[model samples]
Target: MSGHAAFAVTVDLAVFTIRDGIFSVLLVERGTEPFAGSWALPGGFVEADEDAETAAWRELREETGVERFEGHLEQLRTYSAPDRDPRMRVVSVAHVAFAPDLPAPAPGSDAANARWWAVEDLLDGGPDAPPLAFDHATILADARERIRAKLEYTTLAREFVAEPFTLPELRRVYAAVWGSPPDLGNFRRKVLGTDGFVVPTDTHGVSASGGRPALLYRRGEATDIQPPMLRTAGEDD
Candidate 1:
């Protein structure tokens, strides 16, 4: 085992949510060295006795203080570039998590601050975009694409809304992720036609603008869309 290199393992999370129709991700300002003061995905080194997923959840709770989450959480991929971490050889197991509009986060001891940033603003290469620490920008971009693709053929969209939600609420989740809204009529038909995608309830949701109340629904038993709700160009207009 002579001359064998030792590496550290970490877990990075791309925790996403839709707030006021804008898709956002949780980021923290690193308080320590290597990227001090830079914003990065909320994560940290994996513990010696825990798995990657457990570390991901732990980091999420510690960095963001999100204890009650009822949404999707899954492993995205791994990053093991030799130069990824300037300090030493490090490999990261990335995870993608989705939740409904989450509350403001309290930064943990390792972070200077924590807040939600619009995913578009971070990836748009604008002057206002804060530079991400390490390789988080790449991990976030990949996670965004994964959510967008999954929304096309899965009930993953439901993870963005609370139960007993209206169709409009669900539609907005798609709009937030896809960067545009789907056609109202087409979206309704597709969702209703796709059995088990949603279960209608007798109650209706009150419109804030005094419009007619909309029917309420909850996520159903199905996980896959039958024909798949494919996004099309100019469908929003």
Candidate 2:
């Protein structure tokens, strides 16, 4: 084992949620060096005894104070470029998570601040965009596309809504992620026709404008959407 090189493993999370009709991702301002004061995905080095996923969840709670997450979580990819982290040789296992109406974040010990940033603004490379630390800009972009693609054929959109949500509410989730609203008539037909995609309940949601009450529904038992709600070319623009 003499002359063997050593490297550390870390976990980075792209925690996404729809906030105020905008697709947002959680970010933290680094409190220490390597990228001090720059924005980055919430994460930390994995402990010797824990796995990457466990480290992800642990860092999530420790950094964001989101103790209860009832949504989707999965490994996205890994980054192991020798120079990705300036401090030392490090490999990062990135994770993607989604939920609805997450609470405001309080910065963890290693962060100066924490908040949600619209995914488009961050990825747009505009004047207002914060320079992301490490390779997180790439990670965020990948996570954004992953969620968008999943919505086309999977019931992943349901993770962004609470139970007993209306069709309009569900459609908004699609709009927020895809950046364009799917046609109302087509969206309704596709959702209702897709077996086990959603289950109707006896309850209704009151509209803010005092309009007629809309029927509410909960996510059903099925995971895949039959016939696949494909996103067309112009729908993303």
Candidate 3:
């Protein structure tokens, strides 16, 4: 039997957020070799003292300068393809997070640059676009699929909005996440009819068009959305 050689494990994060009605993702330009000058998901090798989750959170904070992320953060999956990393045999445990707001980031550690990019622009692969390092493009795609699936049956959509938000704001979250604009009336009925989905705060948001103020609501105690909001056939980002 052949003896096992050394294998290193790393943690990466695919952090997502919505700002100015656009879906954005946090990315970093690698400062070191193995794909220097390339854009990648924020992450690094796990330290001896920290577990995967701790490492993910620490790496995210270090790269993005966002200390507190107010949204759903969870492990997406482990990627162990043989040639995924050019260095040694590396297995990356990629985590995903969805936050409502993120502060301006200052690149730190091995990241040469840090910024939020529009999802459409990132996938466009134009001359000005930065290529993803390692196997990050696949990881980012997986993260997007996981988020879409979660939206169908979980309360995760609420995490993309402020505490007290209008129905339009919440619907925008759904549309942004799904990359498709759902029918407004149908969406409103589904959300309001879903028990424990949201509770009105007896307040309204001023209409930007100077019409009637829109009613505001907050997330309820329910974690699951009954009659899951399924995506349609051929619907894609």
Candidate 4:
């Protein structure tokens, strides 16, 4: 078996979901050697001839058994730390995806037990996550940075909101992620000015419902957020 060293690429995904207005992620505990018994992002070595993104999507399906998920996906970067893998030198292209709604995750394939852990609770390792196996801590930190960037200059926040939402409702999404709320008047005007950011409705909640009726709005087709919703960085919070 001389010169039989295996050559491979690995793909790890940070699949995020928001439900009940809190952020969460999907993770699995490895059941095999080479980091077995330790938690890691849902992932595996890319099969031969598989493209990076394709391998990532396939890994998501195999490990999580999820048929459909709609939201943005992006390449978060790669982990090539020389000492990243103990058995062999390996490189992993990482990814981060957002899910509009929460779905229960179950163990599959090489995972010992699959689960969805809340964002705040997940990192703390209390009833959700434990320090992940491999260099997953670096992977997770990378994913979080990308999502933070996605929050600005894009409509990514709406994915967490229901079909219909008011400015105040949407504002909370920003506040939740930014740790501090943005200026309401500035935020409202910023969104309204951006084409395809939100669409108007002829039939409002009809402001005279014997209460202060809220205005109606839905997701805009435009992906670009004009004036890019500014925010303080996560660490600044």
Candidate 5:
């Protein structure tokens, strides 16, 4: 390992949250050179005293005004392509997180502005869409695919909702994330038939519009989803 050049480490966050029934991700406008005036994910250099996860959370809080985030924050992957960044040799540890709702964000640290953009719009990728700086576009795409894949084999979808949720409400989470609606009857059957998928809360939720009360449920102890919900043709059923 002798004679090798030193490199710097940083963290980039793709924070996705469901707000007003829309799936969105947090973004910050770049305020520094090497792509100034461009939209990008919230992130920064990792301090010498901080670990990768800690640095990610710190940057998330600092840039997006999230003092305390309640959701899953997992390391998506590391990006080390030689020319991915300019100015120096830097490696980024990308992270992805999910939450029910997040407070409005303000510009902080080196970010010129912080805002939430609809995941659909971000994925559209056209001349009219907001462009991402650096390799952030790739990072965001990877993070999104990771969450969609997780939904097939894990209870991670429950993270997008609060407790005492109804079947219809839970189904919407899948639709929003997958960008397509799942058949209600088939979805209900699959969820209920799967052992330890969800447990009834012995309570009902009243609709604000004065309709029939819907049964409520809470997450079960199961982590893996038996008979996974695949996106392939003839697999959803």
Candidate 6:
């Protein structure tokens, strides 16, 4: 087999969370070239005899030391830039995972250290911090767009939220993405009217509003978010 015909496979990860109302992603500081000292998603070369997605899962655990990958995990895209890795022609299989919270984020393997960076911080990251390795900037961008879109169409937003959430709490998730307050009446109608979107768990009921501690609800198994929660325009300002 010709050596030139063989290709290198690398896996990059996008681990995201929302803290204090700001969306954030996990990143590591690279020690080696091809963008050394710069923050990049946790990932590495695929182990020999390992499958691509398997490699992604393993690399994610090794690099992030997370307990599990049971939540929403999906392949974001493949990056095959010839110069992605200066030492060889590397192809990266990128993946993204959404976690609700964290205990800690310590850098593992090639990274000097790992930390959760506020998406706003990164979005506002100036040219001075350090350039990202490979096309990680693009990878993170893709993950974010998917997250935003999915939160609208699926009951997926619940995964990021806690159970028995106050209507106000649930509304906040929408405000985070849409950046606007939803009409109280319309928003409530859409969410409650939608079958399987949420199930009222409290037997008697309590209102979220101080009025009566409105009905407490839990996440329902229904996967589809019917009558989709459409927000008013000017949603990303």
Q: Candidate 4, after superposition: displacement of residue 29 in Å?
A: 1.6
Q: Candidate 5 on 1-237: residue-level lDDT in tens? A: 899988899999998987888878999988889789899999989999999999998997887777767777899999998888887888999999887767889888888899888888888764555879989989999999988888877888887678989988888999998888667766776678787788998889988879988899998878887677775535864
What's the distance in Å from true for residue 144, model 3? 0.9
Question: Which stretch of 10 consecutive residues in model 2 shows the poorest summed lDDT?
Answer: 228-237
Candidate 2, which segments miss by more than 4 Å at Cα? 2-4, 201-215, 233-237
TM-score of each: 0.88, 0.88, 0.88, 0.85, 0.89, 0.83
Clash count for candidate 2 is 0
Clashing pairs in 2: none
Model 1 Cα lDDT, one tens digit per residue, 80-171 = 99999999999999999888768899998688899999999999776678999999999999999988878888888887788889999999
Clashing pairs in 4: none
Worst 10 residues of 4 by lDDT: 228-237
Model 6 weakest 10-residue run by lDDT: 228-237
lDDT of 2 by residue, 1-237 (tens): 779779999999999999988999999999999899999999999999999999998898888776758788889999999999988999999999888878899887788999999998999866788989999999999999888888888888887787879999899999999889888776887789888899999988887899889999999878887666767733422
lDDT of 4 by residue, 1-237 (tens): 788665458999998876666677788888898888887899888888898888888887777776556678888888888778887878899989886765787677888888776655655456745777888877887787678677778888876777677777788887766546777766876788888898877555645448777887898888867557777433211
Off by over 4 Å in 6: 1-5, 124-130, 177-186, 203-212, 230-237
Better of 1 and 6 by lDDT: 1
Question: Which portions of model 3 show Cα errors greater than 4 Å?
Answer: 124-127, 201-213, 233-237
Better of 3 and 5 by lDDT: 5
**Candidate no. 5 TM-score:** 0.89
**Position 3, candidate 4: lDDT:** 82
